[model samples]
Target: MPQINEKTWIIIAVVIALIGSLIYNIISAKKLKKKRQQFTRSIQSSYTHMKTIEDTNKKIYEISNEINELIREQKDTKGYIEKKKKEIEQIRQMIVTNDTILDCTISDKRDLATEKQIAFTYNIPTGLPEIQMEDVDKIRLFANLLDNAIEAAESVPAQDINGKNKRYIHISILNRGSNFFVTIENSKRTEISVTENQFHTTKLDAENHGRGVRIIRQIVAKYDGTVEFTDKGDTFEVAVML
Candidate 1:
């Protein structure tokens, strides 16, 4: 074989160096691409996790609102229960003695009377009349009527300096001709109006509040009683006969 020349040897060395550099560049590029792919996947995963957290937060907010509404309703129910207990005690005493006077008065909140307010008076007969109704029925009738009156009164401005409208409630119970009659009257704000056979609410959102009248009507119907309402445009009156 012919001896290699120095110039040829130098050329061979240069070629080897170029091939090594090319191989190194290809390997580096592949490693960089792999790292970039991994980084993109990590970013996508973080985004997905963040979206999940946001969705969960939204659901929690909705649930909290519903819970708050339910709590308010429960508080109102508890207040009604307390009132009923006191009224029941009075009724029981009257039942035993065959005669008694029942009176109740509730104040409004903020002196605005734009909340549940109640006042009622009932005079039992000196002697139990024949065909006397059950104590439960009587209690139901009185409680429902009083509750409705309170709800109506709560809707109006307690003191209207501008005479916008004054809230008023008057409830009286009478026993006549073997039947019991109750009358409730209240003043309403001019802008608010309630129609018969439909629920009227003072709440900002009707869907959230206003079932007192509906429940009262149901109770009255159960006793073969009649409920009638008179809408005076600025005032309302309800009567029940049992």
Candidate 2:
């Protein structure tokens, strides 16, 4: 081989340097593209994780609201149960004594009268005969009658508007060998409406107001008893014999 010239050697060296530089640039570009792809994957994974956390938080909030509602309902149910328990205790006492009317007067009627500012009086003998009836029937009979009398007494305006002669209610029960006589009298307002011997309610709620008399009549009829309604102008009286 002939000796290479100086210029040709210089040209060959420059071309070798150019080829190495080109190869290095290609390798660097490939590494940068791989890094970009990894960054994109990381961003996508973070977005998916954030969405999952939001969904879980939303479910937790809904569950908390439902738990609060259930707690409120439970409290209401407990209060209702307590009220019924007191009523049951009162009924038990009435049954044990076999004196439903007297018990009603002592318990509910007396308290109601006191609260409504009405004068309540009752004449029950010490040795009154035991009522010969079922506990339920006895309770229904006296409770309905007394309730109606008390309601009517509340409607009567104070005498002379000076509240001098306040409204009054009186109850009397007497034993007559085989049967009993029961009477309830109460102060009333004048201008009572009577349709076919039945008194109409003067209350604003006409639908629910007039059912008490019917119920009382039905209870009396069950024991072959008699009930009379007498509206004495300013005073009303209901008499029942059983």
Candidate 3:
């Protein structure tokens, strides 16, 4: 056999190096893509988790307000006091219970709203079923709805009744064939001032605050439901279909 020439050997070495470099590039590309995907998923999960926490804190704050009010109403009868005491405990149980929060839970939240002088009404069907969500999620969901409704309604004053402003919130649940609906409407004293129909939070620490409607959207996504908002000049309405 003829001895291989140095030129041929160099060419062979160069070709082998080129092949190895190509393989390395392909492997590195795959690793980089996998890492990118993992990072993206991590970011999404963290965002979802942070949003959930923020909303829960809001619910807790709401419950705290109710508790504070009960503690302040010291001029009521003993029977009334006992009744509120049980109500306080019941609301507290909702905070930690694993069972889903239902219309009755909504009624409790409405009571809190009424304490704020915001008239709230909810009409749930006699045969209505529990929403398909966890207890915490259900609370968060209604908390966001009722909370936002209260804020908007508080901003707007109802018919200057006796020279005083009134606030009102109306909520109703409906069963539409294969889906459930929650319709909430609040009185707005002024025209809707949102640009491009965007919802903005007035939270001072906005970086840590979660968007209420966005959080609702996330929860609604799990139910494969849809959320719709209609700002009707003097009324802001939200319809959640699940």
Candidate 4:
């Protein structure tokens, strides 16, 4: 106790250094494990946030599509209203005059066979040549064409069982060389039957309906026009040349 040997002191110092090293290693290992756990938590949090953002973006995209569809529907409604108004005004003018009047307003409701709306589009060429035809005749022809187109389109199924797109109708009129050409196209579920004999309709109920095509043919014939009917796949096309 009075005088410690140098070798013993040295051995004691080595033992102390070994103990300190072990303690330091243990502390460092604990700290390293804690850091690893923190890093893992941070990574999981980031992944969660990313997934949340992705879901949010998908919802936003769906909402945007819905908004766009709403806007399109509104526009179509507006257009239909305006067209009806114009037709009503024309009918009123005809009543005021002493000319023979024809009720040319076609119904816009959905047909019984199909749940889709009866859509119609009309086109009148600009810069029409001066002709001898009366305004009433023009209106009658256009009205009949549109009516027939609507009927044809309504005959087809709007949405299939798989929820596909609805049927539609398209009408175009072009005046060339003192003649007017009208084309009407409609989406069809099955192939349309075209005949040169008596006119036939695919409409199931024969009591109240099924005469639209015959009436259109008569109207076209009254104007000394030629009417041609054709079928292509699931589409029916009617052309009138006057």
Candidate 5:
């Protein structure tokens, strides 16, 4: 309990005030640091949520594309089924016929490619031996042949080839020794595909179509005949011997 000077008391008061201010500033700095950490955590959480949403959206997009592809496939299948029904009917009729070429005049090779601007020629002979199979088979054969010829000839626009336009078909039927020979010659094929003993047409008509050569082979084999397909650079020929 000593008596203190006023100046010393003032000095003590100033020191206490400075210490209090320092404590207050340190506490405030700790509080600010904690707040900043919380803000950083909040931002990270928001980013993670956005990433999840983005992944979900991507999955949904892929699912939508798959669904669209499935729908297109179903539509194509329906069209194919409808087309196959008509083709089946025609094949059935061709299978259950008993008519012969001698039973009637099979007139199918006249101006067959007229609409396609393709020149057609023929030397079909009369009084030939009747075909071993149904005459309907023969009709189908000729129709398919002429159609393929027109398709091939029309693919290459009528152009000058060495001096002449080569968009024409020449078909002949005659007797060779003891066998009936059917020969078909048409414009040269710039593009042709042959596999084994089968042939394909130029049209991209579905899978069920373009089987003309297969049908022709079936008919020829059924009648104990031999068929030949030759590609001669500028001309194509098919010969059937029965």
Candidate 6:
């Protein structure tokens, strides 16, 4: 303030301008960083929302399939009441004729295969004690396997390319030293689809299907057993050891 020179005034002006510019740059950088952070949070929130929507859609799809199955079952109850009555009587008769629950289940499924024109043959060990399993498990395991086999065999043509009838299911049971080996083989028209070493159902009603194999696997796993699926082009075989 004591009579500054012109050159000193210009230098002071330049310094003030430099300081102002530096402060402006610092503020701009902070604002830009805040905006970038906000953008990142927005992207993360969008991704989370998208994933939530996807999961919700998956659950809705599962619920829809279950609803559809329940509706079909209700319709079936109305349409097949008479057939179910006949089947009940047949089941009673088969229960009277067969020795064990397993035998009855196999016989019932075999009769169904016969009606479908799919031959069923089973060679169960004679004089062997009933399979060491709970009655319900035995029925579930054998019934599910035979049901799937019969369904697949039914899809096979009445006569194969060789002009011979090969639509059949063959089941063999062996009493190993400490285990039971059961094998079910059936005719197939096309190659089976396998995913992650598991057989995928080829049935048109996919949602209502697929549960059978999963049930069978659960039963096998309950007994610490192993189930193997082998596809032989013209035939598919499922072998279980318990």
Q: Write the per-residue lDDT of candidate 2 for residues 1-242, one digit (tens) a residue.
A: 99999999999999999999999999999987976775565455445545544664675576556557768776555564565567445433321124534453344666687688888777777578688875556655777788877777888775656648668988888889989998888987786655555877657755544677787888889999998888888888888999
Clashes by residue pair, model 2: none
Model 6's number of clashes is 0
Candidates 1 and 2 compared: the better one by lDDT is 2
lDDT of 2: 0.71
How do the predictions measure up, each by TM-score? 0.43, 0.56, 0.52, 0.44, 0.49, 0.56
**Candidate 5 has what TM-score?**
0.49
Question: What would the per-residue lDDT of candidate 3 be over residues 1-242, giving only the tens digit for each residue?
Answer: 99999999999999999999999999999998976775565456445545644675686687677657767885545665575677555444332222224543565567687777787766766566656676556766877888778777767655485866567888888887878888999886554433444554454533322387678888888889888878777778888998
Candidate 2 RMSD computed on C-alpha atoms after optimal superposition onto the true structure? 36.0
Q: After superposition, how far is residue 242 of candidate 2 from its true place, in Å?
A: 0.3
Q: What lDDT tens digits, residue by residue, belong to model 1 across residues 161-237?
A: 87453656665456778777767776665555657556555566555235556666777787788888777777777
In Å, residue 148's CA in model 6 sits off its true spot by 0.4
Task: Between candidates 3 and 5, name the one with more favorable lDDT.
Answer: 3
- Order by lDDT, highest first: 6, 2, 3, 5, 4, 1
Ranking by TM-score: 6, 2, 3, 5, 4, 1
lDDT, model 4? 0.57
For model 6, residues 153-235, the per-residue Cα lDDT tens digits are: 87788986888887999988777676889999999867555555476665685554478889989999999999988877778
> In angstroms, how far off is 225's CA in candidate 6?
0.5
Cα lDDT computed for each candidate against the true fold? 0.56, 0.71, 0.68, 0.57, 0.62, 0.74
Give the best candidate by lDDT.
Answer: 6
Error of 1 at 228 (Å): 0.7
